[model samples]
Target chain A: MGGGKRRRKLNAERSGRIAALPSAAPAEEPQAVTVADAAPDAPKPVPRSPYEGLPARAFWRSGVTEQHPLRVADLYRKKFALSPSHQIATAGSCFAQHIARRLKGAGYSIVDREPAPLGFDAADAQLYGYGLYSARYGNIYTARQLLQLAREAFREFEPAVPVWRKGERFFDALRPSVEPEGLASAEEVTAHRAAHLKHVRGMLKQADVIIFTFGLTETWEHRASGTVYPTAPGTIAGRYDPAVFAFRNLTHSEVLADFLAFRKRVREVNPTVKFLLTVSPVPLTATASGEHVLPATIYSKSVLRGVAGELYHRFDDVDYFPSYEMVAGHPSRGFFYEPNMRAVANAGVDVVMRAFFEAHGIEAAPRAAAEPRPKGDREGGGRRKGGGKRSKDDVVCEEMLLEAFAK
Target chain B: MRLCFIGNSHIVMVKSAWDEFAKSHADLEGEFFAASGSKMNGLELRGRSLVSDNPSVVDQLKATSGGRTSIDVDRYDGFVLVGLNLGLVNVLRVGQDHRTVATVGKAPFGHLCSDGAFDLAVKRQFDAASSRRIAEMIRSVDQKVPIAAVPTPHASRGITGRSNQFWADAELLSARAEQPWREQLEDFIRACGVAFVEQREETLDGRYFTERRFSVGSVRLRGMTERVEEEFRHMNADYGALVLQDVMPHFGSAA
Candidate 1:
C-alpha cells in the first residue's frame, strides 16, 4: 500500500515540477550593457537537460550499440524488487507465459488460483489454459483485452457478447482457449466463467508482483460493447461478424492511456501491487494494416515499447524489461528466431529469461535450461529444442489466424 | 468370525460404528491396527509382519487386545484397512472434484459430469493411495487373507458453522454420476487384490455427503493439535454401524 501511495505522490510531484524548459541560445551581447545591474529582476536559471549526469542507459549512443551486442539484462533498473515469497501473477501474450514459467522455475511464488486439479498433467493443464497464468484467462494480447479482462474479473464490467455458441457447445468468448473443449451449455459457461472471475479477483488482490508482457497492438473489438477479444471471433471459436466486430490497432497514446487506467483500477483494489512490464520480442504473425508485414511488426512493437516506456516513467510501481530489445535487437543477429521466423527459438527465450533473472538479482544456476546446443543457429527450428513444450509456446500464435487464408 | 480393522484417524468413525454394532451382534469380533496421520505412513512390514512403532498407538492397541504387538496372521481371519489412508485425505481430494458448489444452505448437491476423465482421476488417486502401504504390509504377511479398504469418507453435508470457508473450497456430493467413480474405484481396489467396501446408502445425504447426524467431531481424533473447534470429517456410530453391515457378510462367510 505504501508503494502505491508513494507512486501516486511521486507521479503527482513529477507532473507538478516546472517543465524542464530548454535553455535559450545566447544572443550576441551588447558590450556596454553587459553589467549584471541592467535588469530590475534576476533571471531564473534554465533547467539543465534531464540527460545530464545520467547513466549509460539514459543515452541511446552510449547505452545501446556502443556497448556493442547489447546487454539488456541490466536494462531493467527495477523500480520494485521481488522477494521469493511475493505472489506473482502474469497474463499477456505467449511471451508472458515464458515469464511466468521462468519466475515459477526460479522459485518465485506464482499464485495459480485455479490450478488444474490433481490428476491433470502439465501439458494438458496448459492446453486448457489452467497452469499458463494465475487464472484460465488465456494469452491476453491487446491492451484493451487486458483492460476488459481486469474489469470483468473484478465484476466492474460485463461484455455484451458473453457466450459464443457453436452448434451445441458454448464457449466463453473472452477466453475461448481456456476450455480446450467447449463447455456443454451457456449456463455451464456462465457458471465456469464466474468461478474463473472469482479466482481472478482473489489472485489480483493477493499478488505482490503483476507481470504483464505487451504483445500485439491490434485487436478485434465488439462494436456494441467495445469488448476486446484476444483473437478475432472466427479465429478461435466464435464466428466473425464484420458488421458487429471491428479491428483496432491501438496507438501509443491509446495503449498508454489504457494501462494508466488499468493501473488506477488495480491500485484501487490492491494499492501495494507492483507491475513488471515487458514488450514481446517475437514478431507479428500477420497484420491487418495492409502495409508490408515487416514494417507492420515494427509499428506494432514500437507502439507497445512506447507505452512500456511511458508507464515505466509515470508509475513508481512499474518497470519495463527490454525482452523486445534483447531478442529483436541487432546485437543477437536474429540468432534467436526459429526457421519459421515468427516463432522465437528457445535459445533466444533462454537469453531473454536469463537477463530477467540477472536484473532481479536471482541466481541463474538454478536453470535446467543450461548446457544447450549452439545458441546462434538462425535456421534452428529443426530438431526443436526445450523439447516439445517450448515449441508449443512458440509455434501457436493466435495472430496466425490472419494467415489462415494466405495465398 | 474374528476380524482386525487397521487405519488412520478416519477409522475412528468406522471403529466407533463397528464397536457399537459388535456389542449388539455377539457373533462378531474386531481389532484396530491403525495409527494417526503421519504415524500410518511409518508403518513397517518387517518380514510379512506389519507393525507400528508409535508408542501411543501400540499402547492403545495393547490395552484393547491385551498387549499383542504384531498381528498373529494366523489369529485374525480377515483384515479391514480403514483410514491408514484407504479412508482419508487423498480420497476426499479426488472426491472433491465430483461435488458441485452448493449455494443454498442445507441443500442437496451432486456432480453433473461423470465421464472417464473424472473417473480415471479418482481411480488414480486410489491406486496411488498412501493407505495402500498398510494393505500391502498385511498382504506380505499372509497372501490369502481378505483385506477390505474403506476410502476416507467425504465430510458431513451439514458443515454450517464454517460454511464460508467450507463452501468456498470444499466440494459437495452428487448421486447418479457418482456411481461411475464408485465402479472405477471398485475395479481399482479389486485389481490391488483387496476387497472394496462400498460406503453405506443409509446415512448419505445424497451420495456426495452424509447427514449431520452421522458426523463425528474432532474430539475423537488422536495426535491432532488440541483445537477449540470441531472437525466434521469423521462420522458417528450410525454411519460406522453401516460399514460393518456392508462388509460383515463377506468377512463372516469367508472366516
Candidate 2:
C-alpha cells in the first residue's frame, strides 16, 4: 500500500512540473525578445529595483527635511507675492472666503464681480449665498462644477443681462429670504444675474490670479438641466424638483477634466491668467451619501487631493497649496479648527498665514503677550449702564437696526 | 459713555443683570455684539468673512473693524469681552448619514486645528511682532477705557452619566474639554486688565442645575422652590454679586 501511494505521489509531482513548464516557456519569450532587441542600436534595458539605493550625498540635507515638505500657508504667501499686480477672483466652499478675506486684507484687488447691487454689503451678500464665484448661485461643490457654472453662465443664449455692466453686485432673484416688502422685480433679478455673469467673465479676463478652493466632491445636481446647486436645493433655499434632482459623487478624473476645462475657458478669455488651487480644510457638516461619516470624509478629501495632484502635474502655471495638509494632515490631526462646527481656529489661520509669509521671505509681526488687568479694577466695582428692557418691536428689529446703523 | 459687550450666552446672564440694573439707572448708553452661540472668533456674526475664520480675539476685532483704517476705536468708551471659551462651542458634526452626531472641538469640519494647525497659525499671528496692530486698535477707540474679559461659565450641575460620556468620546468633543476653555476665558479677562469675574466656581457650587435636575426640582414633589432659591442666592452672592460690582462705575455714572 505504501509503494502504491509513493507511485501516485510521484506521478502527481511529475504532472505538476509539466504544468509549470508551459508557464515558464511563455515567460522565456519576453527574455528572448529583450536579448534580441539589445543588439546594436537597440538600447539595453536597465534593471531597476523597487527600492532605489540612497544617493551618495545626503540630498535631504540640502533643503528637504524628513517631514512632509509643502505647507499651505507658505504656498499662499508665495503666490500672493508672485501675483501682486493681478486682479484676484475667489469662489468655492466656505474656505474660499478665506482666500478672499486674506487677499482683501492684504490690499490685493479682488474683482468686484458679485451680482448684487452697490448698497448691498458684501459680507451680508455672502450670508445670503451670493458673491462666491460660480453661477449655480453657489453650487460650487467641486472644481468641475464651478467650471460648468462659469461655462453655462458665460454661454447663456438670451443674455438675461449684458455680461459686463458696471455697478451690478447682487442677483436680485437669488437673494436670501429677506422680507419680501423691499425685494427687486423678477426682470431686475434676471438682469442682475446676466450682469453678474458678465462681470464674472470680465473678471476672468482681468484676473492675473484666480484662487479656487476645492470644497467637496459630493454634489446634488438637477438631472434635466445638468445644473448643480450649492446645498441640496432645500437645504438652503430654492425650488427642489425630486425628479430633476440627483446626487453625484465626483471622481478624480471628472475633477481633473473640469479643472482643465476651467483653465481652458479662462485662457480662452484672459490668456495670461494663472490658477492657484487649494483644498478647503473645513470638514463636511453632514453627509447625505450612504457611507460612514469618517470614510465619506476621507473619500471626498482623497478625490479632491487626487484632482489637485493631477492638475498641478498637468499645468505649469497652476499650483496646489496644501491647506488640507496643514489642517487635516496626519501630524496635525485637525487642531486648527474649533470643536462645534469645525470653525478654523484663529491660531490655525495665523499658522497658515505665518507659513505663507516665511515662504515668501516676508517679515512677520511679533505679538505681545496678552496683558493682565490691574487687580484694583475688578468687575463688581465698575458701574453698569445701557442694558435695558425693550418692547417686542424693538427686540424684533434689533438686528435690522444694528445692520443698518452699526459701524 | 458707550460700553460694548462682545461675547456669547454667559454674557446672557450678565446682560440680564445689566438690564435689571439699567431699569433702575435708566441713563446708560451701551451696545452688545452678543449672540446666543457666538465666540470671540466671531464665528456666528461674520458668516464666511475673516472674522469667522480668525482664531484670535484680536484678529476677530480687526476683521470686525473692517480693516485697520475703518476702526474708529474711539467710538466706544469701554470694551467688555465675555465668554472666550471657544472650546465650548459646537463646531463639528460626526457619525453616519441620517444618524449624524454633532460635537464641539477644535477643527469642526476637517482635522485642521484638531491636528495642531492652529498652534502654527497662532504663532504666525503673534510672530508679526506688532502688539500695536491689535492693542492700538483697542486703545485708539478707548484709551484708558477699561477692557473687561469675562471667563466662561462652568457646566451646569446636572450633566451626568451617559450624557457626560459624550464629552470625551473619540467621535466628538466639547470645546470646553479641549483648550483652556475655562482658563482662556480667565486669561482674556486678565489680559484685558479689567475687573476679572470668575463665575464657574459659583455656578459649579450647585447654583445652575442641569435641565434634568432643574426639571426634577420644578416638577417632582412639592416645596422645591426653596432649594432652587437657595441655589440661586448662592450663585448671586458668589457670581452675580461680583459682576454687579465690576460694572458699578458704569451703573453709577448712568444713574
Complex DockQ per candidate:
0.15, 0.01
Tell me the spans in candidate 2 whose CA falls farther than 4 Å from its real position: A1-81, A114-139, A156-185, A363-407, B1-255
lDDT of 1 by residue, B176-204 (tens): 22554566556656655887776667666
Among all candidates shown, the one with the greatest lDDT: 1
lDDT of model number 1: 0.66
| Candidate 2, Cα interface RMSD | 18.8
Give TM-scores for every candidate, taking all chains together and pairing residue i with residue i.
0.65, 0.43
Model 2's chain A TM-score stands at: 0.64
**Residue B128 displacement in candidate 1 (angstroms):** 5.9
CA RMSD, predictions in order = 12.3, 23.9
- After best superposition, candidate 2 residue B157: deviation in angstroms? 70
lDDT of 2 by residue, A1-407 (tens): 69999899779868776445543322311222345556677675553421123331223332234333334321343333544566777766555555555555555576655433212233323322334443224424577557765685578423212111112221232222111121234444454355446656667777888878787877766676555544454322344557867888788888888888888887988887888788866666455578875787788888898888788777777877777777777556666766643455556655765565466454543321321111000000110123222221111111122122223
Residues A89-121, model 1: lDDT tens digits? 997876777778777778889988876655655
